[model samples]
Target: MGARRRVREVRPTDGPLLEVEDLRTYFETRRGLVKAVDGVSFELIAGRTLAIVGESGSGKTVLSRSVMGLLPQRNVTREGRVRFAGLDLVGAPEHELRELWGDQIAMVFQDPVTSLNPVVRIGRQITESLRHHVGMSRSEARAAATALLRSVGIAEPEQRLRWYPHQFSGGMCQRIVIASAIACGPQLLLADEPTTGLDVTVAAQILDLLQRLQHERQMSMILVSHDLGLVAGRSDDIIVMYAGKVVEKAPTATLLSDTRMPYTEALLRSAPRLTDGSHRRLPTIPGAPPDPSDYPAGCRFASRCAYAQPRCAEEEPPLRPGAVPEHTYACWYPVGTPHGAEALELNRAGGAVG
Candidate 1:
C-alpha cells in the first residue's frame, strides 16, 4: 500500500476532536520528583488552533511532550488520559502509537537543528516518513518530498532536497521540518514553538504558513509557546499554564478581554504591545515560578500575585467556570471583580481577607 492506501480520517464529531483529562507527567530526579505537567485538561475541535502559553519553566514543553509520548520513559511517570480521535493514547501499545505518529499525528519540534538528522539529506528526511507510513515507492516518495518543500514555500525545492540540514539557514530548515511533519497529512499537529529561534519577520512567515496549511488541510493544531503576543490573534482557544498547572483557559477573544486569573492578567500586562510608546518600559511579572519539586501547598501563583490573600496561601482554588460560558480560571480573587479589589486592599492593609 502506498499513497493509495487510505488512512482513516477523523471527522468533526459532536464531541471534541481531542480531549485531555487531568494529565500529569512527573519525572524522578536526584533532587526530588518534578511535576512537569500537573493535572492539565483541555479540548480541541477539528480544524482549530489551541495555544498553550506560559513562561519558560511553566511546563508548556513538558505538557506537549507528554501528549505526544515523546518523553523518555526511564525515569518518568505519566498519569491520566489523552484521548485523540476516540483513541486513548496513554494506554495505546507502542506499535499502535508508532503507526499513528506520522500518518495520523505529527509534531514540528522547537528547534530544527536538533530535531533533524545532520548527516541525512533533506530529501531522505522528508521521504522517510512518506515511504514508511504512506508506503510510497522510492520515486513516488522523492516526488512527494519535492512537492512538500514547494508547499512550504521553499525555493529550488528539487535542488534543496539534496542538501543537508546544516547547509540551509535556520528559517529554511524550519520549513523543511514543517514539510516533513505534514507529509502524511496527519489529523493533529503539535507545533512546539516552531518559530523559536527565527527573527521577527521569519517567525511571522512561519506562523502564517502554518495557519494557511492548517486551514487548507483542516488539521487540528496545538501551538506551544512562551510569547503571548505570538498566539494572541492566531489561536481559537488559549490555555495559560503556571508552575505545571493550567491557571486559565478560554476562547482567545474572551480571555483577552475578560481575563480573570491574576497570573493571566499579569502575563497580558507583560507582553509588549504595538500601541505602547517606544520609550515605555514593559512590565515584568515579579518573582520566579515556584520550584516544581516542592510546589507551594496552596495556589501556585500566590507568591507572585499582588491580590493574593491568606486564603490563597491556605487553599488552592479549583478550576471553575467564569462569568462567560466556556471560560474557566483557578482564581479565588479574580481580576476586575469586587472581591479582587477588596483582597488587594486587605493585602496592603496587612489584614487577612480569608
Candidate 2:
C-alpha cells in the first residue's frame, strides 16, 4: 500500500474484449523447438466465460501464459496478435504490459502455494495491487483487501488477513489468490486450472465462488482446465485443443449435444458421469498425445482417433464451420457424419481407419 491517487473508471467497448489471432508460442529446448501453442485463435466477448478444455500438454496452459505475457523471455518465441481492449499485447512494450497486468487483466494461477509468497502476509499480498494499480492508501487498501476476502466467502476476513500462506488450507489459500486477482477490478480474469489439488466439494465451491464473482463484477474470464465436466456448465463457449491446436470449438450446449471431433467425444466419454456405477471402470483415451517437438504433418489426433480416415494422415484438416454456424471442428471424418460412421465400421472390421 502506498499514497492514494484517483483511479479512472473504464468504459465498455462494443467489440470483443480479447481477440487472439494465429497465436504461436514455441520454446527452444534441448530436444528441439517445442510448439506448446501453435496457430491458436479465438475471441472472448466482454462479461462472458470462455473455457479452454484439453488434456495436460495440450497447450492450454501455454496459451494462457502467452496471452498473459508470463512466458520466459529467453529460449522462447511468440508470434501473432493478442488484441485486448483494442491494444496488441504481442507487440506492446514491457512497461505497458506491467501497467495492464494487475489493473486491467489478472491471472489466477494453478497452484496457490507457488503463486503466493510463503513469508508475506495475505493482507499485504492482496493490497499490493490495490495500492499500486488502484491507487489506494494503506488503510483503504487493507480495508478493501478484507472486503475482497469476505466476498470470496472467507469468514473472519479481517483477522485472516494477517495470517501467512501456510496458516490457511489449500482451498482457503486459493480463495486468497482469487481475492488478490480481483482486487484491482480487472476487466478480464484468466483462471488456469483454479480448482487443481482441491477435493471435489472444495473444487465445486471455488468454481461457484468464481461464477458468482464474475457475475457480480461483470468481468470476462478464460478458464483453462482438462476436466470437461468441470467446465461444462460454467462456460458459455468451449474450445477443445489437441497437440498445440484447437480441434473443436462451439457453444457449450451445442458441444455437449453434438460433438464433431473424435477427440472431444473421447474426452466426454472418459469423464466420470453420475450415471456411471461404482462397479464400472472409467473410460479412457487409448494413446497419449503426440510429442510437441515432432508433431505429425497431418491431423495430430489421427493416430488415436477412432473415426480417423486415410485422408486424416495424408492431409491436415483446417478448422471449418460445422453444420451449425457457431460450431467448428478440424476433422475430415467428423462424428455423426456418414464418413465418420464408415470409418468407425472399418475400424471394427479389422481394417485401418486411416
Top-TM-score candidate index: 2
- Maximum-lDDT candidate: 2
Using all chains and alpha carbons, the TM-scores for the candidates as numbered come to 0.95, 0.96
- Each candidate's clash count: 0, 0
Q: After superposition, how far is residue 195 of candidate 1 from its true place, in Å?
A: 0.9
Question: C-alpha displacement of 128 in model 1, angstroms?
Answer: 0.9
Question: Candidate 2 lDDT, tens digit per residue, 118-168?
Answer: 999999999999898777878899889988999999999999999999999
State the weakest 10-residue window (summed lDDT) of model 2: 1-10
Task: Provide the overall lDDT of each model, using Cα atoms, as 2-decimal numbers.
Answer: 0.90, 0.91
Tell me the lDDT of model 2 at 249: 96
Q: Per-residue CA lDDT of candidate 1, range 140-180, in tens? A: 98899998999999989999989999998899999999999
Q: Cα miss at 80, model 1 (Å)?
A: 0.3
